[model samples]
Target chain A: MNGTEARTIAAPDLLEMCAAHMRAGGRMQMAYVWFPQAGATPEIRYLASQGANQPFALWCCRPQPGEALPSLAKISPLLGWYEREITELGGVHFDGHPEPFPLVLHEGARSTLPPLDPRYPADQPVEFEAAPWRIPELGGKDVQLLPFGPVRADVLESAQFLFFYIGEGIIHYYPRLFFKHRGMERRFQGLCPKLGTVLAERVSGVGSVAHALAYCQALEAAASCQIPERARWLRVLLAELERLYNHLHYLGYLCHTTTLKVGEAEGRLLEERAKQLNAKLTGSRLLRGIIEPGGLRRDLDSAGLSDALEALRREFADYTARLERTDSHLDRLISTGVLTRKVAVDQGATGPIERASGLDRDLRRDHPYAAYAELPMTVALREAGDACARMQVRIAEIETSFALMQRVLLLLPAGPVRTDCHPIAASEGLGWSESPRGSLYYAVHLDQNGKLARVKIKSPSFSNWRAFPFTVHDSNMMDYAINEASFGLTTAGCDR
Target chain B: MPLWTFFGLTRGTATTAWPASGADNGQTGVLGMPRHYPDRCQDDCDACAAACLPGAIRVHTEASAGARLDVDYGRCVACQLCTEVCPAGAFAPSTDWAFGVRARTDLVWAAATQTAPARALSGMIRSTFGRSLHVRHVDSGSCNGCESELQALNNPFYNLHRLGIFFTPSPRFADLLLVTGPVTYAMRAALVETYQAMPEPRWVMASGTCAVSGGVAEGGYACAAGLEGILPVDVYLPGCPPNPAALIEALLLLLGRAPQRIEGGRLAD
Candidate 1:
């Protein structure tokens, strides 16, 4: 096969070949069980992308319905969560799943019937329920489990967490998630592609632009439509601004945990300023209503955000300097909630988390989506896997985003920002973008009528949260707030 | 460090001088709720109605006038798509973020419709808690759209504490309960329990379109169409998620500290 070819393999050969690919340093990027028709059987597809620059997509599909599906997660433990999601939504049992717990569905939750299942009855009530939080048997008898939040202290999104501790030092924790689920995937089942873009924006308010961009890219791919050159550059600009606002919030909150009130205020100030800039450019602060199928709903370059961006650059330089001068702030970060390189790679961690751990994985550079192909990308990397290293990576990325936004504004190719995109029919397209937190992958399947059949959104938080319990292995409970803040994981993104 | 102290002192008072000092309440640059004009609406026009994604706009045709548009501000996301597609100048664009009102009916904007008469509040309760307020914010099931704006209320820019409003973690100390999200079924019991925990005469402010009318996810499997059926809402502040200034305006209106500035989806004089 060529450098970028995807070869579909048989079910029996999936586990063996996938292991072979991983042995050659490959990663299972995204896995989803897609439904074809109302009465037709669903097929499990695994997107296997390996190699740094010389990359080729190897997508494996298990075609047979009645046969025992080979669980690739058995070989790679990181694939367990995705496999669990596939099993729950498809209502199919994997042969040898290790952690076969519920990932999305929970107790007292009643959602759509397994739309993929041939025997799925429209009237059948599939109760989405979960048993009591199973505290893993660990440490000693003195270790007590303390429950925290569906309604929390500061954050907006909702998710319950069970903390297991012997004394003050935290040991183990289980996140009882999915409280913010709007049944997003089930709702996108038959929406028109145009309306689907609107729904995709709400997946995570913080990552709205990236999600909508990803969804739109998938829509364009399904329709075999190419958006205008100017729209590509505009998408890049909006995505960079989105990253800026998100990183500003992430950095601000992390500093706030250290009782740095002034820094927190400054962070929020910068965030609001960025939102104002976004509103001026895209007509929405969160960068919504701009990203649509085929192109943006409006052209941002015409809005002339260049002068405003230049001002941001000057302000950010000073802001970063003032915050960096505080040695005590750095003291709280160094060696706090450290994630090892082995765990980050083996578990397929992404975004700043992976970059902080020196994994050198970024969808923007490796996958080259949108206008990224137009620019020379520098994927920031850090050797240290601690909180300080993570912050360093993020700050460095924020600086880079400032420069990137300027580049997008200056070098933007002149053309139409949109083109006519017709309804797609019976096609599947994969959309991946480097969101503020990390890589966002969306697998969109269109029905014969070109309506949205299914959309599986893969958030970077999903992968990063798996490493969270591991990051808190030896850190003090007090330092946990700062540690989690440094990671800056969004529960809304994860829940959706 | 002395430098840190210097920087802190140098950046004094970034707060907007609103209400007391006549600051621009963020009405510039951004577009807000759409204003509907019945007289100007063309006969048999459904362009804006069809363009509305969340079904915020509906057309009711009469024999005399032919077509009339009714906008449910509760369901309106303020994406301004209706303004973009309206053939006639009927659905005009507005930057009206100060859409906070005492009654839920104030959110709906039917062409040629007048503002609903304000309902009388219990005078004893209003007299009990006069001015300074303690707010208990519950993220019933928001995507964090409203929550983000709510957080901004504490920033140096908004500086909500100066206005006598603060967020209390415990429902016990709260005078007003601020609710976000479309009120998912899983969160309904918790919301009820929190509401119960609050002292008597506690007012609930539904802060986003989702909490007001479940914006896009309205009537989904997991949730109701916002806080309508769940609790008696004292104030309905509608937007996709109201901006920070709007939230403040809503809070002030709830406390009788500020007057309702929007009537029938238009800025009142």
Candidate 2:
């Protein structure tokens, strides 16, 4: 582990150690069961970090036969999703786990063995029968339930939402997402590191560069390959470019939710321009097929990037200023879908969602990936934790992203963009990047043949999705879409 | 004056005059699909096939044919790994982005003589719903790339609604069922239910490489090989995530409002 510390501890000591780590202000980033060889006991790994310039601390353990591991969900609520996934996919049991239910697999989906188990046949299909979502029973007068999606209104990702609302006000909200889970992590198994970047880029289309950067950096660490200076700076540029478009789209989509048609059109037009800039710089509108393990797949011409940045800076200023002064949009967002600071930290909120809740943690400044360590970066924060606060945080971040991109272009070094990278056998590494949404991590484990043994993705949306229902539980139905747009959560990221 | 109105006037019109001949579809100097040049392929070379993660390019060997490259553009995600790894320049980087076609057979390329591609939509479909097309998009399992582009279609730059194409929330009112992703097992039933709900004259368009032939996640544990074997796909537009312009072109081509630029897996002038 290049920038992390790994410890092998007894399975029983896991909970106590994790509690101590949390007390020391470290946040749990990822927890997954790693299956090495056939018939071998599954190894559970817990990764945590205190953010910014702190090395990741990973604790690994293997439970004894029939010994159920103590759940970490009590200490960190977000680990419930991880533990539920571990149970359904890895067949691991956690004692005293709250809300012990199938997280990834639907009710009627069947498999002879856990899909993550090495003994499970890859060719065998996991048979699925369309089963009704297990929405909880909440008894209250006038609290009628309305089940929306897997197929939702407008061009939204598939996820079912059970709204237990009293007329227009929501009493309880239960979301059943992951309808778009394409076995992304499992697809990485047996793939060469070169092709792994391709799959990673498609993990979340909008977060293509961030995902690719994280995946490539993981492999790069495994190979002990130092990417060229130009490539690192270029990575920063591309990442910021992605952030620019995503934030712009978020703003536009938020407007769509608020019924601000003119604002929506303007924001989308700017987003389209930003995408065109991406196309001009990297040949891919979504900025895919450009990044690889060692470095960039090809060199980018920065000649036009600066000119585009200048034009965008002027246009974005006008857009955001108008948005801030707009009373109707601000009024709708001000106190709508409020998530307090304590709940954000407890539910493991990352990215802008956590930032809006007044948690001043940013991986770019904290973990310092790519060229972020060298580049001057600022973290945007807001205390309100409402839709308006989330919008303001994104607005500030868009400004920061623009500044960062400009700086990268100014200081981009001249060198070969790529290096010869070959994965080392039986090597593994952890890589993280501050994606447009939040901290995205890729854990790569290579087999004996230098092929990917297993890859676990911790997408920011996965963390934020766990934190989303908190805001909707007592909110109104009218503000639900606005709240969601403000958070900018994607089901693909969560499902993957 | 209202701030929006003032800004709108200053920015002027951002819409592109595409689908009306010689307009920039906004995809300039962009790499589309990899153009397969079998003539330039070196003997005993399998670099392109090995590099292709989606198995879009395969080398089929037979006693009569010896060895030949079989390329299915439908399966290509346009990663361009083939173009990079091919030492012989067998696969060239191309900008021939407009690949929307009526028949699935039009997307598969072979070293042998190609079969004729399908004709335009029937007179009933053309005459009945040529001017207006209502689409119901289902994300069986996408990375949200297709959805991002789909949303962009409504942006001022593209404004697909100006061409009489609208995304309807209800499948019952839709004339076209646009499907994206690899048709993940979890989303299959929902996709089917949506198609079943569409009116009798409904058509299905497999939008994106994942929808066309599952792209990279094809045949994985969670998903099938896209909409091909699952549903009757009338229009197949393949891209990792097609740009907004490509989506508009595909929708128009489906309504028989535009010509099918790709035939037998080759882009025609």
Candidate 3:
């Protein structure tokens, strides 16, 4: 899995090569379909990365029209979602795929050709007529079905949960998310690299900096444009700020789910303070409108950045220390919605979820991007594989993020924050970032006019959401909401 | 529990006294929507229009006169790209975060014609739900930026409940339907159903630039251009994702508890 360049293998050897990579401890990072040229036959590509500090192994195969390709889901169950996604969007058939229903396209949704297929007429509109999804039947007198939402309570995103539970215990759990899909990846098409940052930042509001950084890096990689040193350090600063706010928000939301109202209030207040810091440092609270392809959109005035981080750090330590002392919060998190290490790896979990499950991997450390290689970071690991472990992972990561931000600010260089990124036509590149939720990757393909031809987003939430359902089955309904909160998933990330 | 209570008390009044005169709205030095000066704009220059991706700025050619740039704040994401690209110093970045208005037409601006003043809500509607308002938020196709600001409204800083506005779980109990995103087709049914479920005198507020005029993902294969022709909207607040204080101002303006500061798509100084 250490091959740096993408190799075009025949369709027959795709499964064998992937299996070998899997046997060598390589995990499938992402797979997608793209048209190599205008009206060209679609090619399905697979990307896999070996353990720490190794280059990704990329393999692609173009199947003749109507040719059924071998399913890699058998070798790695994590590929099930990607395979099904390719089947629906790329209009490819996977031979011997188990349980091949529509992954993204809902029932009664109509589109000419698959939406991701380049041949699909962009001008023609796709209609999503509301129709009932096929829910797997469960037999038993006590087993009843409950469809929770496409619209839920509170300020949560749109996602529906189909629960088949008997009494308090659950028989099965199925989540039908992606109600918030805005065709974000497609929106990148024909956009200049400058405007692309705006759309990438909006991919997931909380992961704004991470997505934008990854997108810009991909664009930079394509053109081999070397951004300024100050821009790299600033990217790290912005990234850490994003992680700080997201983790704090996650902790606060988790507190609400556990009925820790005071803890929730304290956490949110701290989150608000952190956001205010972001606003004071950068004009935008979410740190948007500052990242473009070559570098930052503007130079930041980080005069009081270290002071703000120190103050936030002190308050956060006190808050988390109090939470640890409270037994009620711990009781709800312990042993609730346990996702075993084996299941986590088998289902290809990433970020804190994987680290909490004892799969020690951080893209910042393993495959360093931005200024991460220069900074000292401790990848937090836990063996519990439960909600408590997840919370602990986030708490530890927040601490590391604070330290990293301080280091980045101290070593900040003086130079221009941006450079001219002249796009190289017909070039493709891969870029990644270790976001608060997990590792996020953006693959960009540039057109003749230096605009985006095709852009594929491998968001962390997409991977985590695929692995989330494993913990829900056979678990009681009581801990469902808390489990969900601990995962800290966003429907926009998945749906996009 | 006692420790938490004492700890909370010691933090000492984190709430801001906004909606009152000279209060800190918590958005000091933050960039808001782009402010346009028709006089400063060059007649042939369309740099801002070309830079705006959401099609918020468009140059319209009229047979009777010169080309006029139609500026729609409803579609503006406030990315400030307009200001960055404008050569004639026409589009200036301003801190006018409070851009909420009662009518959709109030969001569109043109240099040729003067716009009418924004109208306040009807007396009956305002008086009916003046003291308190229950809101049901729907995410038709948002990227969750709007939801983040919505969540921030409950923080101790903003404390939206103090203003008699609450986010309810049920549309049946909702007086106002606060909608976000560009109204994607897949969510069209659920959004409409929620609107139908609400009782009479129910109003819809399109928060964020996406809900106002589809933001950057406008006219895509999957979504409609905001809530324009889908449902009748009462309030239109535009931002890439409006900050928390802006949400409070919009909600308050909707309830007739606060005055509409935007007239003819221009912020009142």
Candidate 4:
């Protein structure tokens, strides 16, 4: 499969193509399918995985008029939502989706059609209907539903589940959300490419680098622009640093919640030290404004890079020593929220969560992007899928990320940070990167005026949310908080 | 009962006696009027006006003098961004944190003409100390920055409990309501309910620019009005998001320990 080789197939043959790709031992890296309302036709393009020996395979297929695209229920039930979302956004209708409703964009809400459609106007009043999922009521002699917050007493961006019990055990857990919905997706439309970076960074304040990098990759790909080698290396450094900090913060939160005082203290110290190092390197403790399209806004000096490396080494040793002595902390986390390997795969969980569940899948290694292709990465795995298993995976990944950062810094190439990128004409492209959470996918279509026509960002949170309910099935309700904390799911990332 | 108890009984008393002391309660002075320096002006800069989330700073430009900056301390939330971003270091926050006055007119002190007056509480030698305050916090739809720092008060560093400030879970038990965020439409009723539940002699302390004056979310449909529009706010601690130190000072001022002035820079112990 070559880049120039695009195979066009009828809509009825969409599922057959997917089945064929799977049989050929090809993995679906990303799939971007769109249909103009006027044309009422679907165009499917995907980068399928062949073996390591072959280049990335690209395939394009379209359904003929009055024909239906194949359903995903045959391949996997999880693909149902993905198919429905593509249908709702691009006006493509799937023949046999078990459930089909708008995923991110609200139903009936006014939105621009696919960029290829000339008949659809830009802005219109769109009304959105609420999703039709019955809120499960736990009915027992004493069981009741308790909604904690869309507005919480604490200053956190999430909802809580309280399972009212007589004394020690929980009866049911009710989940609530939509607290801080700033209408980010609606605002992303018609935004200039440069300003999109700011929007992406705010998607998840903690996962700022990941979101920005993914968005930049999409923009770069669409415009056929090349980022400098030095910038690519720096981008990887920032991404890995983000991953390290997020994992550290998650571990600290888990410790704090579980009443592991020493472990909590160590986690806090690691976070503070990491933040300070990040500040020294990027001026902002959160590493904002560091990543821009084409490359970075500023380059790291040798002295700054050296200081970061030194700080990393010092903190890593201290953290590792503290982790070793804390057996009690490990006891609380292990076997807590045990997601079985079968369940993890069925739910399509990714990142540390999937890897912890004995699934050795990592975008950095499986589908290499940016500097990851050249850098060595070891996929961390644990069979437990419990809270402790997740923590172990994160801990291992942090060490690996630190090593990768050190390697990148030692082999620092001399070049410019940014490349002069020209605006791209009307074209569509898919961008995928491994965010700290999981695989982040962005599908973008550029208009003739070089403005963003339509963008569908499938953040890792979207896919990972499905796995949460399954993990809490047999586990006690009290452990749910620890389970969620260990996952470090950002509501902002998911909501956006 | 142990051998160590018998040995420890031989130690002297930990109490200490000092010189004859007055009934001097450890209270800091009030904030003073803000001052401005002309030399620190930057070209085409009106940050004092822009950074004023309360819309307190008024910038006037004439043909000869270029730009003139004036701040209304009454409207100011004391966020200190003007001082923080002043390129010429012209805007100085006065150490005189206390500026308790009977009338609202006395609160508005111009920076250019006014001299730093004597501490406001120095003249009032009162025998009466205020009662301990019970503060109730309400989230009126803020960015959570204010609430984040506010939560830090419970931490070991800024132990708000030591300052006679207790956060009540219910507004009924609260003597003061610490409201953050601009009053969103959804939160307006809750705000009113919380304010109504508090007993008489009750005071409201708007803890951020959003609470005092709708900071960034001013004109949104979600926002109703600042805390003043719903309840009477006695003290205002301003910042895009106020630091923990500034928050501590504001709470202290409410308890008659610290003074309220438009001073900029670091808070002295």
Per-residue lDDT of model 2, residues A242-271, tens digit only = 999999999999999999999999899899
Each candidate's lDDT (Cα)? 0.78, 0.88, 0.87, 0.61
State the displacement of the C-alpha of residue A194, model 1, in Å, after optimal TM-score superposition: 0.9
lDDT of 1 by residue, A154-229 (tens): 5356777778887887877777777776666766776778888777887787888899988888778777888889
lDDT of 4 by residue, B140-188 (tens): 6555445544654554334466666787776677777787766644456
Model 3 has fnat of 0.72
In model 1, pairs of residues that clash are: A106-A129, A107-A129, A107-A130
Local error of candidate 4 at residue B157 (angstroms): 8.0
TM-score of 4: 0.69
Docking class of 1: acceptable
Q: What is the TM-score of each predicted model, taking all chains together?
A: 0.94, 0.98, 0.98, 0.69
Please report how far candidate 1 places residue B256 from its true position, in Å. 0.9
lDDT string, candidate 2, B14-103, tens digits: 888886867777877667998888778898889999999999998876645533788999999899999999998889999877789887
Order the candidates by DockQ, highest first.
Answer: 3, 2, 1, 4
**Tens digits of per-residue lDDT for model 4, A111-190:** 45632243444333233333443455556676554656443443454343555543445555544433333334444455
Q: List the residue pairs that clash in candidate 2.
A: A52-A366
Higher-DockQ candidate of 1 and 3: 3
| Model 3, span B1-269: residue lDDT tens | 67887898898998888767678888876788888887787877788888888888988766446336888888888888889888888889888888898877677774444444444464556789867999999999898888988999999889989888899999999999999999888888899999999999899999999998889877767878889899999889998799998888888888777778886678754
The interface RMSD for candidate 2 is 1.3
Model 3, global lDDT: 0.87
* Residue A295 of model 2, lDDT score: 91
Worst 10 residues of 2 chain B by lDDT: B111-120
